[model samples]
Target: MQRYPMTPAGHLALEEELKHLKTVERPRITQAIAEAREHGDLKENAEYHAAREQQGLSEARIRDIEAKLGGAQVIDVATLPKDGRVVFGVTVVIENIDTEEQQRYTIVGEDEADFKINKISINSPIARGLIGKSEGDEAKIQTPRGEVEYEIVEVIYGE
Candidate 1:
């Protein structure tokens, strides 16, 4: 099985979601299905069909989360050496070589990436270019806007 590299928080988030799905969503869907079933005429029961579809989707998500959790290899950033090199679970501060703009990005697992929060996937083009690079190293990454060069300003081990 391919192991998924994730931060400790990412693993915990997935576990929390799975718990919510099992404890909250599953029971709610089951209750909805039961209530719909009581309405009779199963063939014409739209509520029953909707509830069943929702149940299927919820179950599928639950299985996906479980599989992801099983494959997860959680890495604690705090345990890593605070070397200047960028690696998985490190927050890298980069300065745009051309635009002179600075941005902070935390490299994380695919499921934990949220651009709005500056959490980028390890597989992302920018992260790929930044990985294994030390502070002050220049990385040229290909993006939708074209090739952009950035200078690594700092590599942070933890949040």
Candidate 2:
């Protein structure tokens, strides 16, 4: 099976979610199903149907988390070489070549990417352009709008 590249923080986050799903959600859904079963006939019990559907969804999420965790190759940024090159689990500061607008983003796995937090997926166009590039290097990315060029201002590891 193909292994997934992920930061240690992302791995921990996934593990925590899996724990919550299996420990809290699984038991809670089981109890709801049981309670709904006691309410009335199985044929037309809305509560029972809802509970079952919820159970199915919860179980599916649990399985998905488990699979992701199992396939994960956790990389701790702190252990990286800190060679000033952009890579997974590192924060890269870049400036738009044309607009001169500066921005900071952390290169992360797909599941760990949150634009609000300035974390972009490794597969993103910007990250793909930035990867293997050191500070002071210029990267050209193909975006939906068009090709955008960025100058790498800095590369920080373990941030």
Candidate 3:
């Protein structure tokens, strides 16, 4: 089994979503299916077909969440030593060598990556470049645009 590295927050979020799907969405979809079944002929009933399709999608999502949770290895960054090295679950501050633009990004699992919130996936180009590097180190990252150099200013854990 392939182990997925995840932060404590990401694991909890997935668990919450799974619970919501089972408790709320599953019941709602079942009710919709039941109500649709009352509308006479099943062959030509669009509502019934749509309800079934929705149930299929919801069930698939639930299974996916469960599988992810099963394979997840939650890593608590707080327990790790603060050695100033960029690693998974750490919030890293990097400054662009060219423009001097500084950005803070939290390295997280693939499922928890939200670029708008500055949570980057560990598999991402920038995060891959920053990982294992120490503070004050210059990292040259390969992005979609081209190569970019950044200075690692800080590495914070549990932030």
lDDT of all the models against the reference?
Answer: 0.95, 0.92, 0.94
Q: Summarize candidate 1's per-residue lDDT along 1-159 as a digit string, tens digits.
A: 778999988999999999999999999999999999999998999999999999999999998988888888998889888889999999999999999999999999999999999999999999999999999999999999999999999998888
User: Candidate 2 — which pairs collide?
Assistant: none
TM-score of each: 0.95, 0.94, 0.96
Range of the 10 consecutive residues with the lowest summed lDDT in candidate 3: 1-10
lDDT of 2: 0.92
Q: Candidates sorted by lDDT, descending order?
A: 1, 3, 2
Badly placed stretches (over 4 Å) of model 1 are none
Candidate 1's TM-score: 0.95
RMSD of 2: 1.2
lDDT assessment of candidate 3: 0.94
Model 3 steric clash pairs? none
Q: By TM-score, who's the top model here?
A: 3
* Lowest lDDT block of 10, candidate 2: 1-10
